[model samples]
Target: MRSLFFFAPLLRPHVKRFALALLLALVTLVAGTALLGVSGWFLTATALAGAVSFNLFAPSATVRGLSFIRILARYFEKLVGHNATLKLLSTIRQWLFGALFPRLPLPDRSLRHGDLVSRLTADVDALDEIVLLAIGPLIAALVLGGAMTAILFALLPEAGWIYLSSLLAAAIALPALLIGVTRGTGAALVEAAASLRAHVLDAIAGQDDIVLFGRKDHTAIRFAEAGETLSRLRRRQAFATSLAAAAVTALTGLAFLATLYFGLSAFQAGTLSGPILAGLVFGVMGSFEATNAIIRSVGKLGEASASAERLHAIATLPSAIREPLRPVALPEGTGIAFEGVSFAYPDGETVLDGIDLTIAPGEHIAIGGPSGAGKSTLLALLLRLRDPQHGRIAIAGADIRDVGLADLHARVALLSQDSPVFFDTVRNNLSLARPEATDAELFAALKTARLDDTIRALPRGLDTVIGETGTTLSTGQLRRLCLARTLLAPAAIVALDEPTAGLDRETELAFLNDLPQALANRTVILVTHAALPPELALRTLTLAHGKLEATV
Candidate 1:
């Protein structure tokens, strides 16, 4: 519950809309109760008059007026309330995305892709009930219940205490009890639903592997288990809600009977009129309407609370890397230096140890090694994706840590081993590297990566929309497409990790042969196990056992 309050600041801008909705809702309930009371009074008095010189003008007009007001107020209340809730939801999504950007490359891998999607979509959606369902209805119940109690006191004091006690029990006690009973079930339901979604996504993503390994049946069984867990929790929560609602219904009946008993005693004592007694009894029935909504919303309160806690956990995680307090400007050259750099993972597995190296501006260097040699770790360090455990990495005599990450990244572009070809147009994918690049420049990069001719033959050329992960393209073509994007960046340095991964030997050699001309005057750091052509004039180094050694 306290976690839910963490987002209160986001509600400030939309408070007016919510407040107006609340006002209309209160008016709707008041008019409804008044309508019932007035109609009863008017009917009873008419029956008693029996054509005796009775003036039915005022009561009849009021009954008609209250009914009309009730209808209009209810309509506007729904309109305003839903509109405000949607706008609030939009703001929350924007805010969540904004909060999410700087925390990229989250350190916690326990949060699967599908689970993260659930938090961003479903969990954020559950918060809508905070205003429209829970808070609004609870306030309406309090105000209406209090007003009804006061009227009973003024007109028939004997029933006032009875009505107030029943109102408190129905409006406050039962709802509280419902929240307590369903709290754990509601939380379990959220987790169960998220787990089910994760299972479905995993199955879809790994269907090919599951089939190859003959584990399709196992996967299907797992999905069924997740579904069953979600269904059972939902049933449990529904049962709790129904029980509370039944309790409220029984209490309402008892309150009515007790109120009637006192009203009758007062009437027999000649203290109460028949018409007034009927009106009060009818109003008592109408006042309990507010509690119905309260009871329903109480069941969702626990779900909302759990969702809030989940969202808060993700948003508050400490960033993997922090920006410098007072950043220094990057110097003029691209000369790189790694001075006494050492790094180890959280489990104390050293990947790089006391590495020291330097390269002059415009140097083309290749580091070749077996897998798990920490070649990619070196690149990540250079890009400031992770800070080194010890020592400094400098470019042009400026410590990379002392410069702004954005500025440092702007100067050094990386094409990682797993660089993705987004589900978008070839033009849009290339534009990610340089949004303002002209079509001619885009074509130049593609041609350098040896992919221009293939793209030119596509149905829409640069306007073609590619499938997710570039499924429409061949593996080698997708790799080249990503390479084209990296080469298109306007950085002074280019870092390529396994650039020739999916290419044929002929294409790989051709790409390496064209590399020097394609990246003229820019420093290049290439990490791959591919053999370099002798004529390329590139310096080579090898990494083994947490150390770098120059190749003979």
Candidate 2:
């Protein structure tokens, strides 16, 4: 029930369309049942009149009018319902993606990319059932069924009671029974779907490792196991759905029998005319069609509930770094100061301890440390990706926590080893820094990062598409592409984390030799294990065992 609240705001703006669609559905179903009753009653009355004194024109016109109305009503009903459904689906996709974007930086392993993708695509898709299947059907069934019962009651009271009782059973009690039967199954199905998706992704991502370790067979078996588990859950859910449908059908059939029995008795007593008697019988049969959606939707409620719960869990995650209530504007300087900065992971291992450091505007500093010495953590903190457990980090004499997030990000740029090179046009990837950047600016950034030659050699130059994860580019090219993107930003401060990693000695040395000239006047923090070049004017610092030591 709580999970359904996640869609409150998402569905609010589209409520008008939803209401219109439901109205159209009710009209379509009601018109269909009325057409059936009218045809039955008219044909019987016309046949009787033909034997006495024929008047065919009026009855023929009425049947034609009802037929046309029925056809138009059904066509428009489908059009409106489908249009609203598609629009709602588009909005939900956008909303869910926006909500999940900022939460991607979770370093604590609380979320997985595969699972997130599943939630965004599969889980979000499941929510459509709430609108199309559940709510829309419930409204149509109640309105149409109630109105038909009232009409029957005016004509034949006993038949009306039977119709109302059976409707109540099908529309209300049967749905409850269906929901109870499939209550836990929905959650289980959702979990199984997510797990299957994760397992398939893991197998694909680790295919190389699996092949090398002779575990390919084992991986295949595990994937099959996941599929089998999903299959079994779906089978149980389908069975429950079928059972619910059977119950509704049986109830509807019983209502038809009761109406026929009562209609015959009323006709014999001269309380109801022959035409009206046939109308009541056919009306009861036709009225049950409106409840078809109710039967189908009852089973789906459980699945939608599970999807909602999964999506809500991700949407409500608290930010890792809390934003200030009133953030100060960043000053017009690049100097950074870390005052008694200390940090520890969620597992309580201290990564950085009381580290104090400062760099003046336009200064370049290189940091060196062994693995696990928290060198990269320093870059993360400086960028405000995570707040330190203690102490303050300030940029341009203002605490980062007190600076607007967008402003702080604009002032500092990071080119890390793990930065992604997306599968897109060369120009488009570089333009991520500044979308409005001109071609000349892109070329300039490319030249600065020494990647212009590679782009020029490509078939389409900047317009050429890079394959997935930039696999089309060489290792060195990919690295330079990421560097080019970072350098394209108009940031006052730049943090390069192992910037030249994975490059050959000559390429690495060449880039390092030209680094100072390329980044002239920018405050730089370079985290690397390489020895500093003699020509560059840099203050070098080494970190060991969670402590920083300066080396001249």
Off by over 4 Å in 1: 46-68, 421-428, 435-481, 500-514, 529-537
- Candidate 2 accuracy as lDDT: 0.85
Model 1: pairs clashing at backbone N, Cα or C within 3 Å: none
lDDT of 1 by residue, 1-552 (tens): 888899898899999999999999889888998888888887888898864677888888998899889899899988988898889889888988887777876777689999999999999998984786888878988999898888888877767888888889989999998988999998898899999999988999998999999999999899999999999999999999999889888878876887788888888989888888888888888888889889999899999989988888888877877899999999899999999999998778999999998988999999999899999999999998888999999999999999999999999999866888888999999999999999999999999888999999999999899998898788778877887898888899999889888788887888788789878899999999899999989899998788999999
Top candidate, metric TM-score: 2
What TM value does model 2 have? 0.90
The TM-score measured for candidate 1 stands at 0.88
Task: List, residue by residue over 323-414, the lDDT tens digit for candidate 2.
Answer: 78998888899999999999999889999999999999999989998988999999999998888999999988999999988899999999
TM per prediction: 0.88, 0.90
Off by over 4 Å in 2: 46-64, 102-104, 453-468, 471-473, 501-507, 529-541, 550-552
lDDT over C-alpha atoms for residue 535 of model 1: 95
